[model samples]
Target: MTTGDAVRNRLGLGRLLPLGVATDGAWLTEEAAVLVLRTAVQRLPAVTLGRVRVSLADPAEAAAPTVPPPPSALPPGALRIEADFTAPADRPLPTVASELRELLWSTATHGLDLVIEETDLGVSGLSDAPAGPAGHPREKDMTAARPPGGRPAQPQGPAALAASAAPGVAHLASTLGDPVHLASDHIRVEVATAAGHRPLAVVGAVRESVRGALGNDGRPVVVLVTAVGTAEQPAEG
Candidate 1:
């Protein structure tokens, strides 16, 4: 198989739903695609993403025909994405928007290998600086304790659930500041280690800690410990 096929196979790409009958390849789910793009945009300097939406430009056009077309006949630009965000007010509005547009375009076309017909970016507001990607309040602490007489809110989605569980796992593993990447089915954490610490022991501790913390959430969790003694790093795509 070719390199692309190999990569797709490794990623379980065959399971994804196809964009249309014409395209032989499948496309990532709208949620996953949005997450990928949102993460990329959130990382851009001075940009704070507020809301994101991803969908087809023409739902009717994307609807599959009775007879599936051949792979060679697929049309391009099948997907459309919309994002609302704030950027530094000091930067020229057009310049900032253009940069943001280019970043989104490159990430979709190159990183995700997905064709996007359009990226509609709206400058909803301006922020002085970029917001922390890990600044989700739920991830800050996972204790059952809450303000007296106040009930804890339920986690309504995969992302929120993962964020809620991350802090407890981090605390138990003694890597309270490490990065956590959460998906619907899995959670990958980076655990820290020291010169005298046992590498296997640390990994085992982290696994047990997060597993216990998560406590039968129905999602299979995967906890990964970073290489021993590596400096803390941000989550990467």
Candidate 2:
């Protein structure tokens, strides 16, 4: 494969963190979450971010979300955000680090609606000058976002229609096969979220919409958020 292809491959999502509690929650892609996080961090003064990653703080004690993550997502639980940053040498280092830590914590919890447990910080570089506007959100190509095993979205009758029509949902997806999967005990759908909405909120709306459309069949409705659209990348029809 080409070098760009290889790099892009690595950019594909790592672990899908749970958005809510074990009873009712949604899975969010690391890349999608990072896009929101990076944007928020860039607003900080005298700080330039380095590598950033999010994962379960303690997988051993993590509880799986109400809806188990698909094969593409990580096991559910409280997660953490760890990153390397450059602080201004002129300012008090502790203060700068504290600001960075608060920003990470607030963005992950309040902004992204993630169930984050920790925010680990490390010093990577020091700068005397103020931070510049070189910060750009991750260029994640989420046009093809879908459930891990799902391919492109396919016509799944009324069920697919209901899922797409839900608020905050961009569209239905599957990395490999049809977007909607039907089983004896449950129904699963992977979706890309619409811009300007929380991924977890979108997931909840979708679950409700699909559930209503399908009626009470004793088969639970499952929704997975595979991709989230940014302001620059508005969701498609």
Model 2, residue 187: C-alpha shift (Å): 2.2
Residues 128-218 of candidate 2: C-alpha lDDT, one tens digit per residue? 7754443432233232232232233655688888888889877787642367778776677778776677766787788888788888666
Using lDDT, give the best candidate's number. 2
Error of 1 at 88 (Å): 0.6
Model 2 TM-score, 2 decimals: 0.77
Q: State the lDDT at 77 in candidate 2.
A: 80
CA deviation > 4 Å runs, candidate 1: 1-21, 63-77, 130-237
RMSD of model 2 against the true structure: 6.3
Error of 2 at 221 (Å): 2.1
What are the Cα lDDT values of the candidates?
A: 0.45, 0.69
What are the RMSD figures for all models against the true structure? Answer: 15.7, 6.3
lDDT of 2: 0.69
